[model samples]
Target: MGFIKKLGYGLLAIVAAVALFVLLCAMNPNLTKGLSEILYGKDGNSGLIGSNTSEEVSAGSPGLSTPAEIGLPAADSGIDASSLVPYMPYNGTITTIPENVLGRNGYTPVTGTGEVLSEAQAKETEESIDKGSDGSNLEFDPEIYPYYAMLDSTCQALYKQIYANACDLVSSFAPCKIVNTDQVQYTFEAVFADHPELFYVQTAYTEKYTSDKKVVEIDMAYYTIANDLENARNSFDSAATAIEEGARQFPDDYSKEKYVHDTLIQTVVYDASAPMDQSAYSALVNGRSVCAGYARAYQYVMQKLGIPTYYCAGTSGEDHAWNIVKLGDGYYNVDVTWDDTDPSSYDYFNKTDGDYAGTHVRKSLSVYLPACNGTQYRNLESSAPVSDLEDESSSPSQPVSDAEPNHYDPYFDPYINNDPQKPLDYESEHPESSPTATNTSGNSNTTASPSNAAAQLAVYGLKESDAVTTLQDYYNDCKVQLVSCGMGDHCFYNIVPESLFKTIESEYGKQNYLGGYMNSALKTIGASNCNIVIQAERLGGGYYRIWHNVYVW
Candidate 1:
């Protein structure tokens, strides 16, 4: 009986010890986890319920529906990371709409990047934006024409396709959907029909997707371009350096431009079948290329000199290319290729929009670049008429004063004395060209009633403060003459002296206030990049109507 009693007590003691151990582990999970790790190493305990580890918790939580239920985007939902957009810090909270948004620094992008554009005062930007009334078909969009016009036709098509495919790259870093092979192939062909200028893309193909546009597990393939950008960039650098060496032969943009114009005509011949003639490389390197090469080379050199210039392409009867040059007080279309015929002629050089009219048919994709109206540099020391020039005999016998009743500003001296090769006639040497002239300057358009430019910014998703800042900035920078400041469903209409367009660039240099105005407008609207679409109209002698959708891009 004593032996049996001892055995029973021992068994009871063992049971109590076991129960205590179990209670300790239950109270403190760390105890069990530590024990498990000691006994079985890492991965010893599978996900125990209610663990705070996201990796473990993410798999499943007792009654949890999905990641979405936990305020997280669902797994396998394309986006994999926290953010997919480029780093653009939000300026502030969005509140009531602003009065004026664009704080004009005078520099607005023609359409794309690296194109010598107008910088928003704070140095913001405009890229590719479609100002189409009908959003369905982007190709037919008229507002984007100026952007397209700035590039060679092939690049115009390329930029359009890439712009239309903005969704393909931005799934929050998710795997891109496999696109239709046909569409991908078409884009590739269109983009490289003659090799793109800005895209820098090499080989492109569809990755993973099944047939049937619908119900197919997909990845977007359009903007997922494989860039073969290195070699071409190297080539452009070399070309620019080489051109700059030669450009040093002349002083200012005007002189350098004329020298380049004449040199290109003297050096490069117009060839119908020049090899690889669509690039600046062919024109600058090989000294043999077609119109495209000439135009590209011209733009490259001009931009280096701090002069605003563009490679403009269009159908001059058939496929052709040329340049847009800002010289003296105006923008003109210069066809180095056309001017390079036997003996070479200046007839096609420095022509206005009206001058190039009926001759240059702008590509549909080009941005609506302002018309080339100022005839100052027309024909460059030759037969082209300086339309504003009065007959030498009609000049006032003596000098004019600020109080004079002349139709033009007395502050602006017309550079009346003439020297044949000097188009501006030493205007830089005179007092009229002083930066102070900007303050005294007045345009007839300013006499019109001024409207509140801020009211129109609401369409661009701006608060009243931002709107006021933008318009006030632009008004201060551009000194625009208000024709109207009315709002539409998604745009604004305003008027300024057309003369402002021509002089703003020259007066303020590249540091003009319009650049700030544009950047502010972009921030107000929350666009990731800058591409403000503005439509310009010739309001007759030195007046313009600008129809703009300020935040489309």
Candidate 2:
């Protein structure tokens, strides 16, 4: 029994000690209940009463102050409440309302029974009505009303509604808000100062009103007008400069005509095609240009320089374009496209209409320049019908005699005509003879027979003279050939008949002894009516040993 009591007492003492420890832990704020559980061998897995694990604890005492609560700096703390206001769905409501109702009285009753109300209640009701009114009774001040009304209705309504939603209204006052209330007054003042034109009552409004409406309206109008005018002035100045530059670049007055001619030649690169246009002739911009571009650009620049120039488009071959420029007292056909060749050649720039028109048969100026009347120029080619031969006759080698016949020739004389069948009577009568025939009236008596006289005259006519002249001219012209042959020791010969030599000698002077030797040599050869061939040998002594041959005809 003694052993049992001792053991029982010992167990009770242990329990009491545990209870005291728990109470002590509970009484100390720093000693958590979890510490006692761990000491007593409990699982302690519940949150703050958990076993000694590596997990972090975040729960703090209820009375502890957080960093934010203690006024430590925080993000977005200074943001405006109005900015955080939620977007309200669109609803039709006049937002800007006057504090005083337009026609409502403060003494008005709440019902149709007309029960009289206390002044304070009446005033409170009036303020409530004003706050709820759709702002229809609002009156804008005269000074700011015009500028505000000038805004687009949509923008105006939006602005007013935004202001109303953002504004604070007193619940117990007569009028909800005055026209000159702080927000409305500041906005009205700002809008007026910025855009004074809005106050002037313009009918139509622009985007200028929505942004910096005042500044935009004031600056845009004047700036736009001034800018446009400045551009126009600059364009005119540039055109004038181009004209002056052109004149200076090509200082020669005759250059214009030369340009015209050369342009025409190049225009017809070949007979197979028509002339090139402005784009094709751009290569000549520095040197020259086609008639159309030249005339148009020229006229444009000249007009800037106060010179009267016209582009004339008329028909020539197919269709062509040119210009007619006004000089001092006359207007000449200034076909610059035609005159762009070598100036020294008669085909250079400054040719008359007759010179150009004569080259072709159907040389009409109808398609040359379309702008100007053909009658404007004095030398304008008559629009008379010309033959195709005349139109296609631009060949430089072609003769002018084949052109229009003489005005006096009534029968269209066949003798002077280019027609091969209608040969001259004189030419047909002496068919065997050359182109030249001597007049026999003076030398007719010298021969015994008429036939013999005719034969002699025909044989000794201008054709023979021409042949002799041609030979002499060739000799004179080729002095270098003669000298070279003599130095090289080549043979030379004279091959004229003795009779012809005698006639030549009689007409001129007596021949030297060498001439007699030549005659003797010809007799030895038994040849008459021959061509002379001269040969010379190049002997060592700066002299040529001479030889001659007589070739009989």
lDDT of 1 by residue, 484-520 (tens): 2111124454444434444432322222222434334
User: Candidate 2's residue-wise lDDT over 491-510, tens digit each?
Assistant: 34232322333333322111
The model with the greatest lDDT is: 1
lDDT, model 1, position 265: 65
> Residue 177 error for model 1, in Å?
10
Q: After superposition, how far is residue 396 of candidate 2 from its true place, in Å?
A: 28
lDDT scores for all predictions? Answer: 0.42, 0.30
